[model samples]
Target chain A: MIIDGLINGIALGCIYALVALGFVLIYKATHVINFAQGEIMMFCSYICYAGSTTFHFNFILSFFFAVIAGFLLGALLERLFIRPLIGYPILPVVIATIGIAMVLQSVAALIWTFEPQKLDPFSGSPYQLWKVSISPVHLWTIIITFILIFLFSLFFRHSLVGIKLRAIAEDLIGSMASGIPVRRMYNFTWGLAGAIGAVAGILVAPVIFIHPHMGSIGLRALPAAVLGSFGSIPGAVVGGIVLGVSETIAGLYLPKEIKDVFPWLLLFLVLLIRPEGIFYTYEQKKV
Target chain B: MKKIKVLAIVGLCVACFLSFTSNTIADTGVNKKVILVGGSLDLTGPAAFMGQGVKRGINLYFNKVNAEGGIHGRKLKYIAEDDGYVVAKTVSNYKKLTLKSRVFCLLGSTGSVGPKALKPYLEEDKIPLVGPYGYTSAMFRPFHTYLFNIYATCEDQAKIFVDYLKTELKLENPVIGLLAEDNEIGQDTIRGAEAQVKKVGWQAPVVELYKRSAIDFSSQVLRLKAKNVDALFFPVISSHSAQILKECQKANFQPLLFATATATDLRFLKMAGDSAYFGKGLRSFATQINHRDNSSGAEEFRAAIAKYDPSNKDPNSFNLFGYGIAKILCEGLQQAGADLTREKLISALEKMDGYETGIFAPMTYGPNNRQGTDSVRILRADHNKKDFVIETGWLHPE
Candidate 1:
């Protein structure tokens, strides 16, 4: 039972981690929280559904279609909503993201009509690893998430665009003085986050089913980002895994009524001890 | 000359009194030309499918009746406000409908919580709420005089499930398990199942409760598997039920799964996919006949949809329910006679006995009975045909 729980938790954690990575990416590069990350994921899932079911595209084509659409959507939203509020207070920027979330959710609902849709699972059946049963979709989610994390790590460390974005994150005014295209970098960062969200959405849709309000899953992933110190990419992954595994384990052993709240409970305990989180070190900003 | 003047003045005063008394007896929503009905529906939220289906169904029946010259030379006008499944919004909409729109009565409002919240308002205002779409026993248990329930309570369905397991399946001593949402509906299901178990002198079944927003059911399924129960009663909505079925398939736990009428839809088959096609599939208790069935009521409903709502190429169970309930309300309206008032409508509905709407079982209501039906038929999903087939005749709670 414990092993099965662990495997299930890890698979579930992969989805949360992928979504949390979107949050971390945006926050790191732009210092703005993307509250609509879940809605982006939901909308992209619908795009994938439209591609596969409506246009009769194959799996690979549908996947690329959704990811590319998500990139453009992210870039467009930043250009329109966020860029206008660039010199405003941080609160207004956060509120604008929230407004964007509502509009995206309402638009998706109008287009899809609140009907939950099905996506074909990645594979036919579950594989039996001794006593633990793992579905192919879940296996693919774990594999794909890890691969994306690796690629992202390499890009941030080695690529010039990634370095430029990180430099903007460190000192926005300094990067502007150095003649870096900060606005374009911000746009690219949001696009990258959106593409990652699309991947997360398509993978999780088969497991959870697709709906306009599936973006509520974003609320769950927010805690994951917070637990990972809000801006650390690797911390997001570790925090998501810890939260998921502990939640499943608690559900297994504890009372059934407390299962949903166990994640928040664990987060509270962790925050009480190490406010900086497990993977990230927090430095107090001297304002 | 003075005597003639006094007689004329007295006759005019008597005529004036008669005119004022005649206007006082007429109701607020019913005028000489039309009868206005209103509803607060979840037309844009999670339960939008249900709200929209019920709305469309009600409109189909209303249009049919209106084209037939309406009841007693008055047209039926239905106005629905979107509550988005929120209880507070439902209350506000109820106020708006009653105070501003001044609808004659409410028909087919969606969600258990919304109707439950509107009970106080219904009672205080002395307005009738006909054919509310919910399964919570609270709609009828204490018998709110103004609230008329059209469907069987979830408790009634649960009892019928237990009875089926004992008699038809012959699982007299089999271990039973229940996985239900943690709400009034879930509580009612537990109460009914436990009541039946006690009556049959069988051991108590295992119970698991989950929130409505919960996405995963791994632990619940695992616990049920560990218990090795023979049959599981899960009276949840269709989408969540599909998720549970997937979890069961992944765990390789194949128990006889029973659900409520809400799962007897094509969407369940779509969401569950092959898991629904495997083994015996899912058996559920249904209040209305399936739309795909060849019964006279179903055929009539389909034909009506084709004619009245041509855009609705595929109508589901919720639409059928809405159509059936609208029929019942129309029946009540007809029975209330031309002198319609809120009290008259209530009396008319209470007088209904063995009134067959063709889509539903024989509905019987009395002074104390607000629940329209107490019987339900069992249905099994056939994924190949993408529809549900009747498994049993009308089964009643034992």
Candidate 2:
């Protein structure tokens, strides 16, 4: 039972990791939390739907294009809306991201008409091993989330561009002096974040119904980001899974009324105990 | 210094002009007469789509009445606010709409949390809150004369579902399973389902609860598939209902599913795709047809809504509910005659019985029975269709 719960928890955690990875990418490079990351994921998922249904592409091709679209849109948004606010306070950037989320949500609602779209691309039934039964849809989500995480880690570790991004994250002025295009790095980080979020959205959409508000699930992952360490990629995955499993267990074992509140309670307790995060380093900024 | 004096003079002139305009408008205004009806619609939040449909319904009836003539010569103004289905926000907004806006009466208020918050206020104000879409036993209880129910209570609706299973479907000793939101309303529904099982003298079925904003219910459905529940009873919010149905389909657990009015919507039909119209459930009220077997009222509703809310045509229980409340309020105002005080409206509402405004099932209210519509009918949604086909006529309150 513990293994079953852990497996499920880790799989769910992978999703949070993907979101957290996006956060890490943007935060490391730009020192900004893209509040609209979830909405960008949602927008990309809608694109994936359009690609699959309207354009009649297979799931993989549709998903690929969706990610690409997310990347382009993310980069474009940064150029148009975000770049103009350079050297300004971070609060305006956060608020601007929020407005962008609103616009994207409204546009999606206007186009889709507030009805949740059903996507059942996969064939066949659940795979059962003893008491543990796993649906193909969830299995798909679990697999995709892991692969994306692996690829993201690889990109950040091995690639030259990734090193440039890391340098910029470490010190923007120093990286600029070292001939790194800091602005391009910022745009690239956002684009990469958008692409990763899009992937997360698509992975989850098959199991869940596609609705405009579905992307807002990203907000729930914020605790995961904080718990995992704002800069640690793997930490987010652990935190999200921990949160999901705890919430699931609480919903069943604990009082049902406070199930939604349980995850936050757990996060608060974790924060109090370990202000540096459970798995990641506690970086103290000297003001 | 010269600039400051000049600015001060301009500001004074502007203030005077504004005051003069206000005085003129106040004197000419025919008492700013509009009967304020407060609604806790989920306008721009998670269940915003449901709110939009409800707004469509309210706008429909109000427009119809206003177009022909005002309700007792007083224009019906619905002071609708977005609660977003949060309890604390609902309480705050109810205060703003009640104490600040001072709406005449709370008509057709929806959402599980909204009514729970405003109930005490409604009671204290002695305001006749009629046709609240939610049907918690608490709404029926402690007998607040001001509180009137439109939909049958969850327990009552669950009992009717069991009745349909026994009588229409002819299923005996049926193994039932219930999936509900982990909230007061959902728990109330579970309680109602459990009671029905016991009352029918059958073995209790499995009861499952999900988080309110759960995106997927496949795991829960998989467990139910193992149980092989013959009939499934669950009251789901708009978004989650569609998710549950899709998951059930994926799992191939096609049990006879019965959802309350909350799940009854065109969005459900679209979301369910091929499997939309395959169940019978309790509606708050269906305004598509009347006891006289005419669609004239429904037709009028469509036309009125088209004129006002022409963009939105996706009708559901909420739309009909909106029409029903508008009709009820209009009738109450008419019965109140020329005098349209809050007390007069309450008195008129209390006196309402056998009053048919050609919209919804006949609504009756008296001193003893505060739960309006003493009965709720079972309506079956036709697959891929807009409205439900009436299965049974007005099942009396159990």
Candidate 3:
């Protein structure tokens, strides 16, 4: 039972990691934490659901179509809402993202009524691994997370556009001085983050079922990103895993009420000791 | 001088129109021929189904009554404002429904917390609000003069589940376990379970609390399996119910699963799909009759909804609840008689005894007892039909 709980927690954490990647990517490129990342995830999943159900597209085909739709959505949102506040402070941009969140939330509600409906492009059957049951959705979530992580790691290391996105993250003005298309990179990062959110949403829909407020899963992602030191990508995965594992352990050993609070308590204690987070990278200045 | 004379003539005509209509339009919503009622429903929130369904039920009953020439020559109009299931919005909706609509009474709203928030205001104004979705015990426990209840509360539903297990299942010592959500309804259900468990001389049951937003229930299922409980009672939303069903199947933890009225819908089965096969042995406690039961009352409800509320021909728990409450309100009006007043209506409601609402158990009320009924019918999950089948008649707990 304990082992089963541990496995389940890791699968749950992988979902958080996927969502945290969206937050981390957006913050990395534009230095603005999009409050609407969760809603973006929810809306994209709805698009995926609509494509498969309404347009009669195959399940996997609709997923890829939704990913592209999500990319374009992120790019469009950046061009329309976020781009205007480029020269402005972070607070205004964050506020603008919140406004977009509200708009997106209502749009989803208007499109799909408030009633929660099932989305099962993925089945709920689990495979038995050494007497431990693992649901297919959870397995897919973990597999997709690892693949995206490996791909993102390579992109950041070797890809030219990835390097430009990183340069923009480091300092927008300096990147532009070096003739890097900083604005274009910011828009590109938003689209990339949006695509990441779509994957997370698609994986999550089978488990939670899709609703307008399902984007609230992003609430946990915000903390995951914060616990991962806000700047480091790998930190997000580690932080999410720790949060998930501890919650399951608490549910198994401690009182049930303690399970929900256990992750936040751990995050609190960690912040108290290491304000810079577990995987902090301090930047050195050149004179 | 000519323009001034014309303006004076127009002003006098307006004043005379107001004076002529003033007698019929009083401060109270009741006029010579119309009785206005209002509701602050969660039309667009997580519980929107409840609000929307109940509204249909209310309208169905009212439409039938209106077609038959209304209660005591007064036409009934129910105006509902969408609160989106938010408490603050429910409060604001309460204000708009009360002040702007000038409703004679307030009818069905969703969620306990929203009604609880509006309780103080309803009390201050001494306004009567009737037949809210039975989620709170606070309404009738203290016997608030203004709030009239028709069906069993969440606590009653929980106790009924336990009582059914003891009496029908013949468990000499029922080892009931609970999977409670971390919300007010969850706590209320736990309290009722504890009461029933103690009554039957059972040991303190194992309790598991899950978060409201928790989509995954594998850990909870693993915990339930570890306990090896005789029965697992979980009162949660439809999706949560469906998710728990799927997870329990995956884990192969087949305890006698019990759910509250919230899970009494095809929505759960539709969401659970093939996974709902695990719930073949499931039992549920609900206040009203299932639409598929095809009882006389259910038939009448279906016919009425089809005739009146054509859009919602298919009835669910929410619509059933509305129909029950609307019938009760109409009775109160009839009992109040030709000289209708709020106080008289309250007196009439208090005097209600064994009043059958056609869809639910007979309700009895008193001056001190505001609760209408503490009874429910048991239903068994039928996977083949993909719906709940009525297994027993109404059972009332002490």
Candidate 4:
């Protein structure tokens, strides 16, 4: 029973982790909490649906194009909406993001006309392990999520572009004084965040049915981001797994009525104890 | 401000006079032109699919009736608005339809939560609300005279399935378990299933509830596995149904799965991959017209939608539901015979008994029986089941 719980926890955790990673990516770069990250991810999945189902593109090709589409959408949103409000009061920026989310949702509704779409980009079906079973979709989510995380780490650590983004994130004025193009980096951050959201959306779609409302799963992953220290990349991963597994196990063994509160309970406990997150350094901001 | 108010009053009077004149002209030709049925829909929310489908169903039926010279020289006019599936918006939209649009009756208003919110207003206004998309006894309790429930209650529907498994399919000593959402709708199913189990000479079945947005049900399935249930009833929506089915298949718990009408979607089948079609459930109503059917009514609905808005082709079940209820409203209006007022039309509907209109079952309504479509038929499907097969003839709940 314990082993089964762990396996289920890890598998479910990975998806939440993927969502958290997207959240962390944007927050680290922009200090802007994108309330619409999940919707952006959900929109990407719909784009994938349009690519393969409506446009009849090849699966891999559709996925590649979806990533590109996510990047472009993110970059454009940053340039047009997020850039002008760079130094504005936080409320308007937050509200602007919310408006952007609404516009995107309305556009999706107009295009799709509110019907659930089934997407299976993978070729094979679910394969069984001893006493436990796993789907190719879930397995793909784990593998792809890890690969993306690894690639993101390598890019940030080794690439010149990555250094520029880090410089901007750490000190926007200092990065500007150092001749780094801060405006371009902001657009890049949005694009990267969009890409991450898209991948998360594609992974989530096959597991559950795809619809405009499936964006709530991304919002649920917000706790995953918060519980893992909002700014820490690795923290997001660990936090998501813990929350996912705990919730699933609680849904079974715990009082069934309170199972929905699993994520919140775990989040509260984590916050009370290790306020910076399970993995992050607790740096007190000197006001 | 004074000048604006005077101008506004004059403008209002002029608009009213023009409308009155045109309506008089229409009256001179045919008298009662058409009874307009309108609805406030949650076309962009969690229940958007249902809202969209119900509306499509109503439009399809209305088009057919309008083509046949309508009922008593009156064509059925349907107007719909997106309520965002929110209660505030639904209530506001209801007011707009009644006060501004002046619709005759509400044809198949959608949503359990939205309708629940609008319940008091609907009753107070005495607007005949026909065939709301979703069913709960709470909808029927305190019995609003203006409203007629077109679908069977979840309890009645669940009983139909349980009775079939016991009497017809003859599954012996069936150890059943219920998997439902943790919401009121899910709770309603659990209640219905428990009632059915007790009534059917069986012990109460194992019941488990999950949140509406849960991504997994493996743990719940595993617990039922320990119980070795003979069959499991998953009274859930399409998305949850897909998740539960995939998890059940993974767990190798091959119990006969039973689901509610909400699980009846092509999307559910597609998401379940190869094992999509392996289940039996009850649907409140089926489209009397489909892509295959060549009914003239279906053609007319298609044409109307094509003429107005050609883009939305894949009409959801709610659309057909709307179509069916509109037909019933037209039936009531036609039966009212002339002197068309709300009271006359309602009285005409009240006197109805076992009235079949091709699409829906024979409905009987009096002061006592405001509920419509009490007749439900058991439907079965296997892995390769092309369409849901009607296992038993239509049976009315006692």
Error of 1 at B130 (Å): 1.0
Winner by lDDT between candidate 2 and candidate 1? 1
Q: In model 4, which runs have C-alpha deviations exceeding 4 angstroms?
A: A1-5, A123-125, A282-287, B1-31, B265-267, B278-316, B396-398
* lDDT digits (tens) for residues B102-214 of candidate 4: 77777666667777777888778877777776756667766778777777666666666577678767986688888877676666676776777777778778888877667
| Descending-TM-score candidate ranking | 1, 3, 4, 2
Candidate 3, residues B1-398: lDDT per residue as tens digits?
99999999999999999877853545567877889888989888878877888888898899899999999988898999999888999899888877887888888878777777888898988888888776658777676888887768768877877777778787766567788788777777888888988888877777777877676677778887887777888888778887887778777678888877777778777787767667436777777888766788888888887788787645677888888888999999889997888889889998999998778788888888878888888787787787888888898875
- DockQ, candidate 2, vs. native dimer: 0.22
Inter-residue clash pairs, candidate 1 = none
Candidate 3, position A36, lDDT:
89
Please list the residue runs of candidate 3 whose C-alpha ends up more than 4 Å from where it truly belongs after superposition: A284-287, B1-24, B313-315
- Candidate 2 lDDT at A286 equals 100
Q: Candidate 2 — which pairs collide?
A: B277-B383
DockQ ranking, best first = 1, 3, 4, 2
Q: Evaluate candidate 1 and give its CAPRI docking class based on DockQ.
A: medium
DockQ, per model, reads 0.67, 0.22, 0.62, 0.48
Q: Give the residue spans of candidate 2 off by over 4 A.
A: A1-14, A46-66, A76-136, A169-174, A210-212, A223-230, A234-287, B1-40, B72-103, B223-228, B274-300, B303-316, B354-359, B379-390
How good is the docking of model 3, as DockQ?
Answer: 0.62
